[model samples]
Target chain A: MAEKVIAGRTIQVNDEGYMTNPSEWTREIAAEMAKEEGITLTDKHYAVLEYIREKALAGETLTIRKIGSSGIVDLKEFYQLFPGGPLKLASKLAGIPKPTSCV
Target chain B: MATKEEYPLKKVLIICAKGNLEDVYAALVMANGAVMEGIETKLFFTFFGLDAITKKRMNCLHTATVGNPALRMPGGLPFPTLLGILPGVEAGVSAMMRKEMDKLDIPPVKEFLEMITAGGGEIYACKLAADMFKLKKEDFTEEVLDIITVGQFYEMAGGIGTQIIFV
Candidate 1:
């Protein structure tokens, strides 16, 4: 019924549990959130976030375990760059209407 | 933005069966795309997929040729399997793929994985596959979140707006 900001992205949830601003969020918002999370934003981060956001908008879901198995060797450094780490960054970026029970 | 009753697949599970460059890259691209679109993504490595995450063999991924329609020979000729077995065949293909990926500014597999995971996607190893491959948990990518079975994978994938993909 109201718009809420989760991970720097505005998401509107209806009474029937639907998302209004599903695709409104952008990679820029993800970057801003990363900065707000006290992680320095880099071109690499932008690239990754942009890629992720694009996929999610295309109707795909991502998991931390999948991300880890993707062979990105610099995982620790990347997570260290984030305050809450990759999962938080992704959850924030996804603009999920509510906190997931799994997390 | 108007609330849509049905959201697109908000979660994805990528099943990796081969560890070749193309296979691994395909998985990464999908995962990256999922994260970008605000979806939760996961990649499951089984069989040869483990090679892509294994530090020792990650850089050694080869090209697929047998029964591949995309295979080509010099001067537009079709390359035979014998040619594919030549010493530099795999290396040459791998190099070309890397070059193209570089031109597109795609990060290396390792970095791309990091970005996806760090962005909120999860990465897991198939426990059966790992055991079959005689791989210890330590042999997997350092970023691996867990080793799970197919049932566990299904459990994670269960929910509305979830997709399961094999690559």
Candidate 2:
């Protein structure tokens, strides 16, 4: 229930700063969001984020197990990309809400 | 002025002591969840739980059809214990459970352990139980880091914001 100005655009967000509207996401915005977490976006990082945004916004349940098999990156790489809380951080940078699945 | 202080869980020690399908899964799910949260996770398998880490038995775990009051028929009918003793019935039920979990993207026990470790979770076997069962390190999957005693387990469990859970 807040608005964040990222990459020069005011976007709706939740209390935790997760974007409320996935459609408002842009590559620039994602980079900025990741920078806040002290992560620099690389091709490999964007690959995982883009994949999840496409599937999760389309009403798919996202989990590490599913993402591991997405062919974009493996499970170990996913953790390395997002460091702390891979699924949660990936979802946030993807401009989607925090992931809900446990696995 | 008063300030808000947040004390988040920094580490978790989970102990699994059962080999039944549901029991082992409960431990796996909790351990995996902790790892996903970026928590420092440690899992110790002892007693019957050792079967879960045993290379030969990890993927072939079974649901205890008998002596389990919670088990039920497909349509909510109270399951009769007599049917549990029937050959293949328990196996069939366990298979169905696996199928259901698979549909939800839950991996088998072996793969689950891999996922946890891939996220930096540590797995260990209890030395006392390992001796009682006459099992050795080679009998466990590559996922296990070592076989250690309770004292060693506690040594690592020490720290602020750390919690130990027994299942």
Judging by DockQ against the true structure, name the best candidate.
Answer: 2
Native contacts kept (model 1):
0.09
Worst-scoring 10-residue span by lDDT in model 2 chain A: A94-103
- In the range B66-140, model 1's lDDT, one tens digit per residue, is 656687765677868876777887788777778776665566777777777766788999999899889987887
Summarize candidate 1's per-residue lDDT along A1-103 as a digit string, tens digits.
Answer: 8775755667675653334465666556555555656766776666555555555666555544444455542455545544343554545644443222221
lDDT of 2 by residue, A11-55 (tens): 999999899999999999999998889999999998888899889
First chain TM-score for all predictions: 0.54, 0.96
Compute the lDDT of residue B133 as modeled in candidate 1.
Answer: 83
TM per prediction: 0.61, 0.98
For each candidate, the alpha-carbon lDDT, in order, equals 0.69, 0.94
* TM-score for predicted model 1 compared with the true structure: 0.61
**Model 2 / residue B47 / CA error / Å:** 0.3
List chain B TM-scores, each candidate. 0.89, 0.96
lDDT by residue (tens digit), candidate 2, B1-167: 99998889999999999998998999999999999999999999999999999999999899989998999898999889999999999999999999999999999999999999999999999999999999999999999999999999999998888999999
